[model samples]
Target: MTVRIVTDSTCDLPRELVERYGIIVVPLTVIFGEEALLDGVDIDAEQFYRRLAASKVLPRTSQPSVEQFAAAYRQAFQAGADAVLSIHISSKLSGTLNAARIAAAEVAAEAGRQIELLDSKNVSLGLGAVVLAAAERAVTGADLASVLAVATATIDAVHVVCVVDTLEYLQRGGRIGRARSMLGTLLNVKPLIHVEDGEVAPFDRVRTRARALERLAEFVREHRGASRLFVACAGNDGETEAFIERVRPDLPGTEIIRGHIGPIVGVYTGPNTLGVCPVMPV
Candidate 1:
């Protein structure tokens, strides 16, 4: 039986990797005022960031609808697939997982099929790493349960830390309050945040961007032990480059993949954001 893997757009895996592994991506909706655009389908990352900067109102995001998942599952089953392993962003952060669960149940009833859904309690590269690992295992003829085990193990081991240039976007997205944002602005403080069970939360705070970056490296060095690393940057090439250079000496043999944060994440993080995600051995 052929096993297919599916994930939502927030995974932030590169398009090439998604296509190469035949991983299906269901896009989330980004609403700016009265306008709604699909995360990556209707609007590209570059365009989304551009609009985000120019818009007078704060943008909001929503998970994909049940119909969307149903359609994707139906198409995969029609192609003679035996089972589907659908992974999604954290249920705590968004309703995407619930929508996927409902769609899977309905599709199973109608077609007498089976779809396994996994909630990756992590977003962006954290979620992407889990999905990619599962897809790789599936290609090697792993069964649904085995593939899910691989995904779950990876998801549990993953850790992400991000530093945003401005707290305005986070405040607008309800991640931080106006008072906290104001305090950070007044103190020129950089907030260090981490993804816990897929929800972004405050981990620590520092006075300077340099100190925040150092703390990020320290966090990874202390917790990662031996693991692969994924680095993401938003609207700041210089900072990202500097981070890579600084960390290279410390992590002698760790594999590293670098990329930019896409629209869904960029909307909340804004520009000049630097993030590091580590996938510990499972």
Candidate 2:
């Protein structure tokens, strides 16, 4: 059976990667005031971030509708595919998974075909890693069940750490209202956060960006066990590059992919967000 892969925009995989793997991306909506734009299609990351920086009100994102996923599934099956595996962002972070589930049900009812929806339980590169693995396996003639098993194992092995420049984004997103209140009272406090089991949680707090980077590296060193690494930076290329340079010597065998954090994540992380995710064996 021919297996197809689907994923949401938050995966942060490059356009080339998506096309190369024949992966279908369903975009989440980004709302600014009364206007709604598709994440990567109607609005590119550059434009999104530009608008985000100019907007007086904070930007918000909504999950793709069930119809969107249903449409994609129909197209895939009509094109001679036998099955589909949709890997999505954490359901705890967004309703995308729920939307995918509803879409899968609708497709099954209409076409009498089953679509498997898998939640990565992580975002950005963490999600990207799983999707990439599944896509590669699918191309190599792996069955849907085997591909999904690989994706699930990769999901469990992934870990993410992010450093936000300001607490305003997190506070506005309601991720750290109470913690921000307490942390903000102190000067020069930069908090490091991690996504664990689909939810964001605080990892540590440091006095400066330098110290925050140090702590981030230390955290990765302690938790990462012989895994490929990916680094994401938002509006801080120099700092991110420097951080990678400092840590490269330590992780000798790990392959690192670097990307700028897109606007969907920028909306919540604000500018100057630096993050790292490692894909280890489960």
Candidate 3:
């Protein structure tokens, strides 16, 4: 049986990987004033961040409509997928997974086939890692149950930690969960954060960006058993490479996947958001 994978744009998997794996990516909408742009479809990371810097107001993000997800599932089925395993960002963070759930039920009922949905419980490269693991399994002729098992195992073992330039974007975007405690405390201090229990939580507070980078590197170093590590930076490639270099010496054999914070995730992370997502063995 052919099992296809579906994910939202917030997964932040590179285009080549998505195409190579034949994964379907449903996009969320980002509204800038009266104009709306589809994440990674109408606008890319460079354009989104450029507009973000010059705009006075923050852009608002909306989850994909139910029909949009339904269309994607139908597309997958039409392309000869016997079953589809849909993975998405944390439901607590965005309604994307809920949208996927609604769509899955509708499509499954109509097609009379199985459509499995999973909440990755993480975002950006964290979710990307989960999707990649499942897709990799699916490509090997694994059934839906086997692919689902791999996704579940990756979710359990994956860890995501990030350092944002400021808490303003997260606060304004209403994504700041337990990380709210780090707000209203400092001006120049970089906030270190992690996704825990499908919600954002504060990890630490650092006085300088350099210290924050060191902490992020420490995060990767500590996860020595991870099979795959993804490093992401929002709207900045230089910093992503620098962080990888900082941690490369420590992790000699682990596969490091490069990820960019896409427009949908960028709306909350803002610019210069750097993080590490490690998928340890389950």
The full ranking of all candidates by TM-score, starting with the best, is 3, 2, 1
lDDT of 1: 0.82
Summing lDDT over every window of 10 consecutive residues in candidate 1, give the lowest-scoring window: 177-186
Model 1 stretches with alpha carbons more than 4 Å out: 176-186, 223-225
lDDT string for model 3 (96-201, tens) is 8888899999999999989999999998888999999999999999999999999999998888999899988999999999999988886889899999989999
Name the weakest run of 10 consecutive residues (lDDT summed) in model 3.
243-252
lDDT per residue (tens digit) for residues 1-282 in model 1: 578898999888878888888888999998888889998899877787778779887888878999999999998789777799999888877889999999999998888878999989888889888998899888888788898899989988888888876677877776553235244343678887778756777777888888888998887677545467888877677888888888877876777878778878777888778888888888
Residue 76 in model 1: lDDT: 79
- The alpha-carbon deviation from the true structure for residue 239 of candidate 2, after best TM-score superposition, in angstroms, is 2.0
Predicted candidate 2 versus true structure: per-residue lDDT over 19-106, tens digit per residue: 9988989988888988998988888766776787789999888889989998888888887777899999888888889989998988
In model 2, residue pairs whose N, Cα or C atoms come closer than 3 Å (at least 3 residues apart or on different chains), thus clashing, are none
Best-fitting candidate, scored by TM-score = 3
Candidate 3 accuracy as TM-score: 0.98
